[model samples]
Target: MGQPLAPPPVAGDLSDRLVATDVWTDGMLAEHGIPVVDVPLVTFGGGIGSFVTADYLRICGVPTSAIRVLTPLETPWQSYEYLTTVSQIPRTERLRSDSASTPDNIWGFPSYALREGLQGDLKQLWNVLVEPIWANYYTPRAGAAFTAMEKEMHRIRYPEMVVRGQVRMVRRRAGGGYFTILTPPQGAAPTRRIAYRSQWVHVAVGYPGLKFLDDLQEYRKQTNDYGSVVNAYEPHEHVYEKLRAKPGVVLVRGGGIVASRVLQRLIDDRDRFRLDTQIVHLFRTYTATPHGTGILKRRKGADGWAYQGFNYPKSVWGGQLKQQVRKTEGAERARLYKEMGGTNTPVRRDWQEQLSRGRAQGWYRVMIGQIDRMTKTGELVEVAVASDQGPQLGSFDAVVDCTGLEADIREHRVLADLLDHSGAGRNPVGRLDVERTFEVRGTRNGNGRIYASGSATLGGYFPGVDTFLGLQIAAQEIADDLHAQGFGSKLGPGRSTSQWWKWFRNQQI
Candidate 1:
């Protein structure tokens, strides 16, 4: 067996002390001299999900002062941009996300295609119009999405509400509301932790953290050499740079989008620099045909990737699939989720052509198996694979694992605290359980409601709960729930139109 996994770092001593308390009273906090700031809403994990919700509330006439976004990120898209860039999707590259899933605009009116068309990219518009039948699905550029979100961020005055810190845990206040503890960066504040008391708490902590495979972790721990075995999410630019300097063989593990992008990057470098680089792709499950539960839902599959336009079937956003999932619960819902879930990537022609060329030239090879063991042997690494053809061994300059699986929610300090002390339970699929309105079902404290979006709350009611469109939908639901409770103005046609006009004019609210 591989080396046992190491424990994650604790949030802080404050988290240990706070986890035992179910409710915190004003007197209790006052005794410790902890400053408590009051706000109508407090959103943690200030990524795209938090930004979308804040944008919705702002559009509904909520003031910046009424909301507090507690996060450590310098910018809303900083985490997302980092992941994409390290995974080979530079600012110039297009994301696999759908064009119409605009996080900046809730209505998704004048989709990315229309915007690109007006900007003189008629090819994009045409491609979107024809879609799967004629042309491959179109996606917005990584930079374009970030640029749009930045514009929305300014229009909503998101910067004014940002509290730069890492959230420890949220505790229910004795009287009402919730106390969200934030640990500000060193030198940013005098206090060790600041507490924000809010009637509504929104948690959008995107993916708890990345999980490197056990074997890879074991190898790194034993040899203390991180250069040979690396994860795609982390910075491994040195791998490519070294390849550019000299001929090398790269063993790429996993068959997801990151794998395809890494392969493309390697091929591009090979063609551009006239370098002799060989690529070996390892797939756990190699698919050879279309797959799905129903005839109408078949997804294209070849080699290993289960190809789809988006992460989930587009129908999950609004059609029958959405309704089906919303109505089901427990085992049925989990079954449906399993049917829709798989590692998939959009079928891009350029990448496919490059792979075809690599195959024809014999520089690229596909292997069906997983790395059983990896050992550093001199300058190269020896990788043992347990394949259908029996045990196989290979030596490569570097082994890049592209399996993009996030660690368990419990790995996140705040999430773990929520599960242990805040009455937040796990859903059928083991993530945070949430209501239809994206509210943590049992996490209501008095009149206050705890809402959540993003990856942490997946498997509740939506299949695409982690996507851009999914986050927007969750934001709308949470906003609507808040509006019902008289927190913000109703975003009816008039308000939506006026705010949309402001967005169009690039005017800050």
Candidate 2:
């Protein structure tokens, strides 16, 4: 019942569009010198992953003001929320979760929704809804929750000391600790000559950004126009906007969650705005028919998941296969990631039902195939699809590639440099190898630990560490590690109680 998530504004002047402009200005940079100041801890990626890490460190007694959340900040989930909600992740959509999941709200405190419910007649529902109790990962408006996490970052003051910049590179200090170099925004130069040296560094720059398929990447490079074709994870507003302007079929390429959400958005627009947006979903695998029986229905689809499971499959969560994954490494890990959760699929049921009805009604159709060639003519795209239907031919108004995402560490210069020059190593899954605690695993070049979270750890040992809850879990682990090493303990249990009494004395709710 909260505000519907705002559709992402088209990218304009980025300076004007992004929030917290003051966090990274030339003046502040000019004010601080290159004098190597030593801080107890540092975390990578100024997103929820780092936010939670900082939060836990604060609770553990490290002054909230002591930690530096190093990264650019438009907001946590800034890109992802845009990708999901604008595409098809709706506000009311129910989440497909691991049964017990919370985003960065890892302390199991309440959100606006849970808090509101706590004051209602359905208080049982409220407590039941509270995560880590009865509620597993069935998230509601998961996208909204992600945006809400930004408020947590601000509320807890994690961003109080945010350095508005991307970490360009890092090098292990000769004696101990590490130094991280950064690239501030285009105009923020006076501070450009600054570096942060710390005893600990936690890397969470989630999967080296985005890696589209070779064919899709080639197509995008060739077209350089996102008018008729678009990648699901990026700003491809023109595709749907074009469909809105001219009513024709939108061929969504992928069998994953993004594809599902994109299709739903098209359907909703078609129904609500009266846009004649027909949709043709091109899934490489034909799942129009159920293939398995029992509780296993969610596993047999592909990737060891029951054909009915959401986002890879339920088994990816603590099931037998997940345990097997823990035992396996190298090619096995890569194969596991490929099989489970590698594909994108929306995690809502009503959308699935809607698409099913569309299939029944003919307004929506499904073709299991891959695109062989795409030629855009005037207002339409001639698509040659390779399918069991004997090489089907179709013309669509636009194609949205929801082919999921992959971020090769090599693409991220900081990680690559660390791997090559700084003595870091890739784990069994071919990512920045880190211990279970989220510390990047390589011979100790210094006391500072380089860790990663988000999509980068997709192939790591933890089950759902790549998701929101996973981010918090990684943060908790990192905070615990830092605490064990004696740092970031501002809000330990004692301090938390003190704050509670302070709130009570203020008569604050």
For each candidate, the alpha-carbon lDDT, in order, equals 0.89, 0.62
Best by TM-score: 1
Candidate 2: 10-residue stretch with minimal lDDT: 11-20
lDDT of 2 by residue, 338-437 (tens): 6554454432446657766787888887777788877767767778888878898888878888876677888987778777766778776677776777
Q: How would you encode candidate 1's per-residue C-alpha lDDT over 145-250 as one tens digit per residue?
A: 9998888888788999999999988999987889998888997876777889899999999999998899999999888989988999999999999999889999
Q: Give the poorly placed runs of model 2, Cα more than 4 Å off.
A: 1-35, 90-100, 109-116, 119-137, 142-151, 186-191, 220-224, 288-328, 331-339, 342-347, 488-509
TM-score of each: 0.96, 0.79
Number of the top-ranking candidate, with lDDT as the measure: 1
Error of 2 at 84 (Å): 3.0
Q: Tell me how many clashing residue pairs each candidate has.
A: 0, 35
